[model samples]
Target: MKKYGFGVDIGGTTCKIGLFETTGDLAEKWEIPTDTSEEGKNILSDIAASLRGKMAERNIGKDEVEGIGIGLPGPVQPDGSVLLCVNLGWKEKNIPKEMGDLMDGIQVKAENDANVAALGEMWQGGGKGCKSIVMVTLGTGVGGGIIVDGKIVSGAHGAGGEIGHITVNPHESVPCNCGRKGCLEQYCSATGIARLAQEALAQDHEVSVLDKAAGISAKTVFDAYKEQDKLAGQIVEKFARILGKGLSNIACVADPEVFVIGGGVSKAGEVLIQAVNQYYREAAFPSCVHTRFALASLGNDAGMYGCVKLVLE
Candidate 1:
């Protein structure tokens, strides 16, 4: 008989699940559509149902699994209740209890999605063999996770790694969902990159591919950059500059050995990483030059692998 562990990443639009063997290998992966009706309670129930369906399809008994780990989009309390998830439509819910009930007595653990991704990188991805690491995810919104001494370092209230919410421009505030202004996320995420490109085009009115797109997106900008579009190059460079500043701020405090850049935008590869690395080195404090920047080894599955780690390690 083979032993297995389950990893689930619950996002606003889809839920990703993976089964891992005891040997730290991914055995199977699956996904289900997320239904956020009722502010996420529906999504939670859907996840429970989907888990059972997957287990049945795989012919696996619940007892054969050691535990289940979940990576969520909101702040998860140390006790496993989801404190708040504006993106997921959850507010003050006992996720562990709810999911555990659906599991019928299985061990279930939850952590913020970004934190889970950080743990995944630390356990099996880019941060392997390193005890301290920082992971920055540049997606629709910027997210981050900090790991120190092989454990997630979520400060009191589980807000320690909310790096995106950090204020970049104290004076020139841009509205944030958290009721703040000039947050790093507003300036560095994929959305931010698109916004920057839009602003550039708005000011210049140049003849660029991005200017013609009905919907401007980070991917469009990146593709434009690859084709040597000067405007797109400018957008990418601006992203690097802002991202580097954010990393520098984080480095000054956490001083991690490596910074793992993840999310869809990271697919831009060396072009993006090199640009950010240049800025990070330039802006970082002189003593903070020891940090190495790497792309996330695990892609979308990082959250699932992270969830598995949440249970085992």
Candidate 2:
């Protein structure tokens, strides 16, 4: 194996770069602003230049490098071609082909950002030691990645692990950001929890700490639940029921060995895990009921780590 590899996680604002030993040890990490001007024409070239500069600074030769693994914000075909990536202003681009040409034909691989994050978690973070796992990121909006047998399950349209879009409440009149109604994101994400809290507060219920909190957020709801607030408990129960049930449904399909929960909402920690697990246990198929649960340890760096792992594979 080569002695070195690089991971590039491109976002709308910046591109996070990480240099790593092929053994999975991160050597150094940094970032460069993403140039989206002119339809992101310069983004790949800029990344290539930055990587070359890094190798030059370290006096490393191209033969010692394995290649680069990239995480993009949109769907990627098996050949590392993107159909459209609004975040990067890219309409139709072949990531590996373009990046390889710029890097003088060094091998390159790419995958959706969320899927790479899951791969990162599976490699050295929460799901370490497991070959199959599902990673759920609970931020403003819900995102997910499914890895089965150490490979990302990017679907035909590159939307494999879209756990959030799974319709939980077909009766829900409110539509999700994806223009769908009653998506799991409507009730399981941080924003979803906040929406639940708002709806709960709107009802005339018993006095609780949440009633007095300055702003209702996922944090406040969890905090109130920790304090044993009656209303907060109800809200959390509802959230857990939906999320656990959603996961149970996923278990019926992917049946991963573990579910690694991450993102800001996951910071609520054990309390959150237990609540959701209870519902998952109740609704999961008996054979899959014992699937483990864990918290993602890599945080924002997960994508970078996954990108490196991609190249290693």
Candidate 3:
């Protein structure tokens, strides 16, 4: 008799579900498109149905599953109520109750997505042996997760590790979706890369090749960097400076043993890591320079794997 668990990572774009052995190895994965409407119950119902179907197909009973865990792309209260999630259009919804109801009394744990990602990294990715690590995802928006002493730090109100929302520039004041200004995300995410590239293109319309590549995005900029596009270099360099400063700030407080960078921008590989590390080393406090920067190893599966880690832990 083998024990298993179900881990679900619910995002605005998709819901990733994984069935894993108690040992944390993912056995199967599935996904469904996310519908971010006030009708979030539909999402919960669908997940329940999916899990039931999986159990039926495998000829397994619910009793065999140790628990069901979820990572939501929103603030999950300690009591399992979602305070607010712009991505899911959820407001004050008791996600644990709702999800448990669907599962007929199965135990469920819910936490913020970033925290889950960190758990996933610790379970199967680069942070496996480490006890304290910070995982940063640089996608359209930036997100962060902190793992300390082998536990996810979900602060009061479950808003712990909201690193992207950290204010890097109060005076520069660029708007963030969190309704704030000058957040670290505004300068370090893939969206930020595009914003920076656009600004550079605006500044020098004549000399750069990006002008010819109108509608260029972060990918284009990275490609251009490989081709030695002057504008792209300038933009990424600036991005590195801001990103490094943000990491250093995080380091000062968390004093994490390792800083893992993941998401779309992370695909830029060594160049991005090296540049940011250089900045982190310079800006970080004396002892903080010892933290090593590494690329995220789990990729998209981190969320699902993390959910498993949460419940099994």
Q: Best TM-score goes to which candidate? A: 2
Task: Show pairs that collide, candidate 2.
Answer: none
Q: What tens digits encode model 3's per-residue C-alpha lDDT throughout 220-239?
A: 88888877888888888888
Q: Residue 109 lDDT in model 2?
A: 97
TM-score of each: 0.87, 0.98, 0.91
How high is the CA lDDT of each candidate model?
Answer: 0.86, 0.96, 0.85
Best by lDDT: 2
Tens digits of per-residue lDDT for model 1 on 1-313? 2388889998889999898986679998989988887776678777778778878988989888878899888778888886678888888888778788889877889998889999999888988878899999888898889999888988897887889898887885468777899888887888888889888988865588887888888888888999988898888888888889889989999999999989888988878889899999999999886589998999988889889887886
For candidate 3, the C-alpha RMSD (Å) to the true structure equals 2.3
Write the candidate numbers in order of decreasing lDDT. 2, 1, 3
Global Cα RMSD, each model = 2.8, 1.0, 2.3
Name the better of 2 and 3 by TM-score: 2
Give the residue spans of candidate 1 off by over 4 A: 35-63, 83-92, 204-215
Q: Model 2, 1-313: lDDT tens per residue?
A: 9999999999999999999999989999999999999999999999999999999999989999998999999889999989899999999999999999999899999999999999999999999999999999999999999999999999988889999999999799998999989999999899999999999999999999987899999999999999999999999999999999999999999999999999999999999999999999999999999999999999999999999999887
